[model samples]
Each structure stands twice: as structure tokens, then as C-alpha cells.
Target: MSRTPQAQTRTQTRKVRAAEPPLDVAAWRPAPFLPRSDARDPALIFVIAVLCFLACLTTLFVIAGDRAAGGWAAQLTGEATVIVRASGGETPDAAAARAAEALAGVPGVAEARALEREKAYELVRPWLGDVSDLDDLPVPRLVAVTLDRETPATGEQLTGALKAQGLDAVVDDHSVWLDDIRRAAGVVRWTGAGIFLLIAVAAGAVVAFATRAGLAARRDVVEVLHLAGAEDGYIARLFQLRFAGVAAVAGAVGAAGAALLGALLRLVGGGEGITPALPIAWIDLLAVLPCPLLAAGVAAVAARLTATRLIRDL
Candidate 1:
């Protein structure tokens, strides 16, 4: 049907308005260059989180173990034992008492005490069978010597003092056990450090692989961005931000899990950690706090390097 001039003009005006884009297009925010999330994101998070959890736990264990070793070594270093044997007309009890008195007068000796007769008997009971009479067993008496921590007496010093007193005694300073503990602590520390480094490397490698996959999958988008005049560094920055965010989330989850387990160890094991060998403190949880930041930093560097290299090829 033929319309009037005014009606025709109104219809044409409506058509033009509908065909043109909205004025709000100028204010529209650009979406992220990369997809907000992906089907593989959760898997990546899980892998990274697990790695971080192991790393953090290793750190806590090493700290606790190292501390326990130090405490044991210190205790052993500050103490010694003297075995006194009766000679001539001396009785076991009298000999022990004389040895204790001589040791107490030593310059570095802190406190010297002669153990009771029953205590001495208990020491030899396993060797002597179930004998009710242990007094006639001819067992050597032991004098416990507590040395001053600042100037602890050595085996040689104790032996010389006993010799000068004209007593038959042997000093055991426990240097052998102390050396073993220190060596074990050193081994444990180095081993833990190696494991931590390995985990970190694995995390970085995963992020790098993810970056390559992401670039390959979104190759078309990357080409378009380059065609739109985006620089290589700019493109790389996008990926860096993406992986860093993922790593940060994963790190937080892993750190939390590790810290929770540590707390449980502290509670369940009482003064010690999961075992008497490991005595974890509440302060150890603080070590996990930086896990998220470390993970993010690693991921960011990995992603940036991978993206930059791949982008150059494109």
C-alpha cells in the first residue's frame, strides 16, 4: 500500500535508527584477550597446588627436624658419665661417692651426683638375669656429671681429674652420638632443600607447557591481535597475568592445606610433631604464607618467557 509522505519519512527514520549501532558502543569495555576460564584450568590448579603442598610440608618438616637435632646435640654436649670401679679396700658405693666429689671440684663441672644403689643394679639387671641380689654382681658404679654449658668439661679433662684423685674411672663424653646427630641434621636439611627446588622447577615447567598450549589453541586470536598492532611484549603480558592468577589461586589452596596438616601434627603429636623426631611449632605455619606469592611469581615468569618466544615465531 502507498503511504503518505509524512508516514513514509517516519518509517525510513525508524529503519535508520535500528540499523545504526548504539551510542554506548563507545563506552563498552573490552573483554579479556584470553578466555576468563577454561576446561583445563581446574586440572592445572590441582597439579600446581599439589606441588606447592609438598614443598611447604617439606620445609616445615626440615625446620622441625633441624631444631630437634640441635636440641639433642646440645643436651649431649653438656653432659658426661663416669664409670667408677672399686680398687683396693674401696666399696662400689664409696668409690662412686669419691668420684662424684672429685668431679664436683672440677673447674667445668656443674653438678656431680652418685646414682643410688638400686639404680645401678637396674642397669645390670638385664645382663645378670632376675637375681634378687645385685649388690654382689661386681658391677661398676656410675657418676653422672652435669657440665657447665659455657665451659663444659671434655672427656680428657674428666679423665685427668679422676687420675689425679687416684681413682679408677672412665669418662664417656658422648661425642660420638653428638657427631652422628649433627651429620644427620645436615643430611636432612640438604635433602629437603633439594626436594623443594625440584618441586619449584616442576611447577614452572607446568606453567610453561600451559602457556605453549594456550598459545597454540588461541593462535588465531593471537594473529588478529598482532594484526591490530599489538606488540609482542603486550601479548606476552596477557599470558603472564593469566598464569599468575591461576598460580596464585592454586598456591593459596595448597598452602592452606599444608598449614592445616601442620596444625594437626602439632596438636596430635603434642610437644613433638607427627613423630617424636619432629617437633613442629605453631610458628612453622607462617612459612606457608609465602607459597602463593612464590607460585604466582614463578608462573608469571614462565608464562611470559613462553609466550614471548612463541609470539615471536608467529
Candidate 2:
């Protein structure tokens, strides 16, 4: 059908406008880089929080264990115990008094004192539970010996000297038990470091996975941006910002929760036993305070790398 000149002109105008583009590429604002589907994934944040929590705990435990090991090493190094036993109708008290005198005269012995019978009984009461027949026990007299600071004597030397003096006694330098404790502490420290490394890797994996998923879901948009000359850095920056924000919030929550738990444990335990052994220095608090920031940095780097790689591949 033939149309009027004005009608033909209107139809031509509509066709040209339709063929040009749906929206202006130069002027139109890009939709939110992070879509609702990816942003609303609560599981990612929860997983990050859990990992951060465990990491915080592992860090604290490692620090505390290291401090405890040092404390034990320092306290046990210069100390020795001498046990004086009764022999051939001689009382333990007489034997202990003689041994204490002999130890005092020894070259490297700083001081030696025999523990009184009542004190010895009190020491055993914690394990034996207030026995009425404590006097029936064949407990040897305990002589607490302090070694000289400059010339500390070894257990063998001390034993030989005491024996030469005709004293019935044995010396315990506490080295055997201390070495075991130090070894165990070293194992714990290494184990904790391994766990912390694993957790950090897991956190990075989570962020990378989320970035890949987001990139996959928005492939068409990314293709448009790529065609429109959007650089990889720009795209990566978007992902970095989004993921870092999420990670920072989640890590803060997790770290805060762990710190509260630690505080509660210390409160309930009354700073006795294990609680007192933990590292309570201000530096420890400083170390823990930046955990959230560290997590956020990890997430940001992970997201940036993942997004850049995926975009380059595309």
C-alpha cells in the first residue's frame, strides 16, 4: 500500500531510532556490578565468619602456648629437688638435715632447705585427699635446692657429691620432664600454624569461588562492558570492593565473638591454672585487633585476582 509522504517519513524515523541502540552506551549508568543474586548469598559470609573465628582461636592458642612454654622453661631451669630417704633405723628428718648441710657446702649449690613434715603432708594432700594415716606413708624428705647462677651443677655431679658425703639422697634436675613439655609445646605451635594457614587458604578459595560464580552469572553484562572498552582493572575493582566489604563485616563479627568467648573463659576460670598461663600482654590484643582488617585484605586480593583472571580468559 502506498502511503502519504508524512506517514512514510514517520515510519523511516522510527526504524532508524530502533536500529541505532536500545540505550546510550556512553551516557547510561551501568547496573549494579554486583547483582542481587550474588550479593544475597548468606552462605558465603557465614563460611567466612566461621573460618575467621577458627583462625582467631588458633592464633590465640598458639601465642598462649608459646608464652606458657617460655614460662615453664624459665622457672624450671635452675631448680633441683633432693629426696632424702631414711636408712637403717635413721629417720628421714635426720637424713634430710645432714643432706641440707652437705648441699650448702657444695661448690655450686646456692641454697638448700629441707621441707618440714607438715609441709610435705600438705603437698600430698592435694593428690591423696586428706588421709588420716598420712604418717604411715614412706614419703622421703624433700630438699628444695637452688643452683648457683654463675656455676650451676648438673644432677649427676650433685648426686655424686651427696653420695660422697654419705647422704642417702637422689637429685632430680627436672630436665627430663621439661624437655618433654618443650617438645610438646613446639608440636602444638606448628600444628596451630598449619591450621591457620589452611584456614587462610580456605578463605581465599571462598572469595575466589564467589567471584567466579558472579562472573559466570553476569557473563552477558561483562561481555557488553568488554566490548564497550571496560578494562580488567575496573571490573576487578568492583568485585574487590564488594567482596572486601562483606569479608570485613563478617570477619569483625567472628573475631569479636571469639574475643568475647576468650574473655568469658578467663572470667569463669579466675585466672588460675590454664587461664593464667595464656598471653595477657597488650601486644597480644593488638595482634588480634587487626584480624578483621587482615581478612578483608585477603578477600580483596583474592577477588581482584580471580576477577582479573576470569575476565582475561573471557
Candidate 3:
């Protein structure tokens, strides 16, 4: 009597397994992590390298911009502005002179400069359209006071002292503005961190997908190795090494491109508010050096995990 279909299928499977030679596990030299001739397609490598380079450069620019903005804020701290409103009959010149004298005697005051009428007019021109009737407009006398860096005066103390001198004085410590700037800087930093994380994830995903495709393409070779009793670890190592190599090359290219872009941007002069100031500290660049190595390491580990899991089921 003829065997059942399931039994016939099992017999055929056994015969096919038996026909395959026991792989000389020791002689089964796994391919190195380096790209095989078929896998070293320049177009694919170039595309990956360009993506990595742009991502790294964008991250560097954001980090550098934040540092430069922070430095600007620190350099301007501890400064105060004293605005003296013009009395009904008082001339701005007279009010400014009196304010300067009172401020000169104040302790911790480093320098005091009364803004010129023309300078003040120019400042308000942006909003007022034109300053033709300067004398009619009741513009206050502004005294810009720079305090000693070591002993900066608080806004309250300065205002109290000025009020005692019989002048209606308003002291602005710029705390609100500074706080806004700091908060903006924090937002930029966090955004940059998020971008870096996204790029890392993208890189890992690309590497993982490429590795999986390469493994699938070489499924026949893997089957022969499996039939010969080669361990899963040995097969996985070959793919891991190849992915590591690709990641390393891509990372190096990306880093170099970032450095070059940074240099070019620095060479271009920063004209007013159009261009951002560049922070080109050696320590800052050094901090980013590990990014590429980390990318390569992550890619290799991801590839290894993916390969081993797939091979185990086979």
C-alpha cells in the first residue's frame, strides 16, 4: 500500500538532508565582515556615506550655535540699564548729567555712559519711523551702567539708590531677556539631541536591513554551511564583520565631510544677523569623535543579533 502524503514528504526531506555532505566545520571559513565583491556596490555605499555626512554636519552646527549663543549671554551679564524719565520742565541734558553724577558715586559702579540724543533717536527710529521732532518728543535720558564683574549690583539696590536721589529711575537688569535666551538655548540643545538620536536609529535600521538582504541573497551558502553542522555563531560573525566595515567607512567619510563643512562655514565672514557665529573649539570637535565609532559599533551589534536569530531557526 502507498504511504500517506505526509510520510512521503518526510522521506524526501530526510533523503535531501542525507545527500548533503557533513560540512567540515573547521574548513568552513566564514566570509570576513568586509564587503564581498558582489556587495561592494559603489552607488549604495555613496548614498549611505552622503546621508551619514549630512546628519553629522547638521548635529555639529546645532551644537556649535548653542555654545556660541551661550557665550554671548555670559559676556554681557552683570550689566544694568538706568532710564531717567524727563521731568516736565527738566532738559534731558540736565537730567543725564545729574544721573551720571549720582551713579558715579555709587559703589560697584564700573562705568557710566549717557546715550547721546542722536543715538537715542536712532534707536527709536525703527519703531517711530522718523525722529524729526526730537525735542518735542519726551525721550528719557538713558544711562548705561556697567557694574564691576566681581561685585555686580542687583537691580533692586540700584533702583533704591537712584530713587533716594529724587529721580524717577527705572533699572532693567535684563533678567527677563537673559532667561528667554537661556530657555531658547536649552530648546536648541534638546532639539539637537533628538536629531542625533533619530540619525543613530536611522543608521542602525539601514545597516540592519542591508545585512538582512545580504544574508538572504547568500541563503544557499548558509544552507550548505548549516548542513555541514557549522555553528550559528560562526555564520553570524561573517555578516557582523561585513556590516561593521561598511559602518566604519561610512562614519569616517561622514566625519571628514563635517569637518570640511565646518571649516568652510568659518571662512565665510559672519555679516550681521545673517550668519551664525561658529564655535570651533578643539574640545567640542573631540567630543563628537566618538559618534562615528559608536555608529559602527551599534551597526555591528545589530547585524550580529539579527543574523544569529535567523540562523538559529534554520
Candidate 4:
């Protein structure tokens, strides 16, 4: 039979196509076992982000509060005050001046000076304001004392020095105040740590719950994949990666929110965070950088554990 050249080429092409091995379409275009989008994803992200935001804020608060406590402790550690009472017809001013001189000579004392009468009155007026003869009463005067940072003088030493000079004075080295500050700082640190840990645990629990829900919702797909020889680990990893990505996005959003709030505090407070107690800084915002990573890690661990357990049971 006679045939055209085009017919011969088409016949040759069909023969070559028939001779080729079957293509593994799956290997070439492998789809994810888990769907990329889920209705619960947005809610989970929001919850995780809120937790991260709280954790980051707690960190900043601890830093600022600790710094403030340290500053206050330092001031008290390097200073003392003296109450000088006049005796033997000596005037209040004279008594204070004499006490100051004696304190100045003590070892570890940096400087001492008599506080003005008005300032001394201001200190006592709060407690004795109700007294009828407040002004007429022989109010004790104050001697301002500065101590060396390394070898600061003790209250006893200041008192002894005053006694040696025949002056009546009581020294207050602010030990009580220092102790209070130390205790407060410790409490703040411990409380902040506890809160941060709580937030992390909450985030993990959320991730675990979501993973369980996802596994339950797609039980059919999971079973098919399991029957088709997908290892439990491989199945678990899909969920782990999926939830980790969601958590990471949530963490970023939360961290950004916290950082912006912190920045606003810094800007408004102007070096002290709107109060002398907290002194937020621009560098503090850097603390949030690791939040997303931390969130992802936590979510990954939680999802992996949950998914692996559920898959094995099935």
C-alpha cells in the first residue's frame, strides 16, 4: 500500500510513545499530604501571637524594673543621712554643722554638709505636721553625707565620729531601704519568669490541640497515606511543619505588636518610659527578634509529638 510521508512520521511517533515507560506523576508533582489552608489556622495564629506578645512584654518589663531597682540601690549604698540634735544651748544649725564636720573626717566618708533648715523641716513635716508647736519645737537638723563607693562608711562609724566630737546625732545608712529594693527586684524577676513560662506552655498546648484536631479531621487521608506505606514519622512531620509555619507567622505578628508598643512607651516616656521606674530603650526592641523562632520551635515540638502519637495509635 502507498502512504504519504506525514502518515509515516505520525506512525513512528505513536510507536515511540507506546515504547516509553509509564511516568510517575506523583514523583514529578508531589502534593502535600495536608491541605495548606484550614479554617482554624487564623484563630490559632491569633492566639499564639497574643501569647508571644505577652511574653515579650514581660521580658521588657523585667529589664526595665531591674535596672530601676539597681539604680536606686546604688544611690542608697553610696550615701547616708544624719539627724543632729542640739545640746547645751547649741543652736540647731551649729549642731548640724558640727556633726557634718565630724562625719566628714570619718574613714570612707566622701563628703558631709549641713542640710538647710527648710529641707530638714520638709522631711519631718509629713509625720509631725499635726503637731501644734511644730515650728517652736526643737526639731533635729539633717547632715547630708556622701560615702565612697568602694569603702562606704557605716552608720555606726558615722555615729561614733559624731559622739567623739561631743555632738548628738543618729546616722541612717539606708540599709532598710536597700533591703526593700533588693526584695522587690527579686520578686519582679521571679514573677516575670513565671509569667513567661506560663505563656510558653499555653502556646504549646494550643499547638497540640490544633494538631489533634487536624489529625481527626483528616483521618481518612491519614489512613490512606499510612496504608500506602508512609512512615509515621513522615506523616507527623507534615503536621509539624504546617503548625510551625502558622506559629511562626503568629509570633512575628505578636512580636511586632509588642515591639511597636514598647517603642511607643520609649518615645512617650523620653528615656524613662513615662515613669522613673521603667527606662525603656530602643535596643530593647531587639528582644522580640527571637520570638518568631521560639514560637516556631515550640509549635514544631508540640505538633510532632501530638501527630506522632495519634498516627501510631491509628
Candidate whose lDDT is highest: 1
Tens digits of per-residue lDDT for model 1 on 1-314? 88999999999999999999878976889877788899999999999999999999999999999989998998999999889999998998999999999999998899999988788789888887899876666889999999999988778888998999899999989999999999999999999999999999999999999999999998999999989999999999999999999999999999999999999989999887777689899998999999999999999999999999999998
Residue-level lDDT of model 4, residues 133-179, one tens digit each, is: 56687889998899999998888888789889998888899999999
Candidates 1 and 2: which is better by TM-score? Answer: 1
Candidate 2 Cα lDDT to native:
0.84
Ranking by TM-score: 1, 4, 3, 2
- lDDT of model 3 at position 53: 77
TM-score of 2: 0.77
Candidate 1, position 134, lDDT: 68
Tell me the TM-score of each prediction against the true structure.
0.88, 0.77, 0.81, 0.88
How many steric clashes between backbone atoms does each model show? Answer: 0, 0, 3, 1
Compare candidates 1 and 3 on TM-score and give the better one: 1
> Candidate 2, residues 13-77: lDDT per residue as tens digits?
99999898687678888568786445456888899989998998888778877888888876677
Higher-ranked by TM-score: 2 or 4: 4
Candidate 4's displacement at residue 43, Å, is 1.5
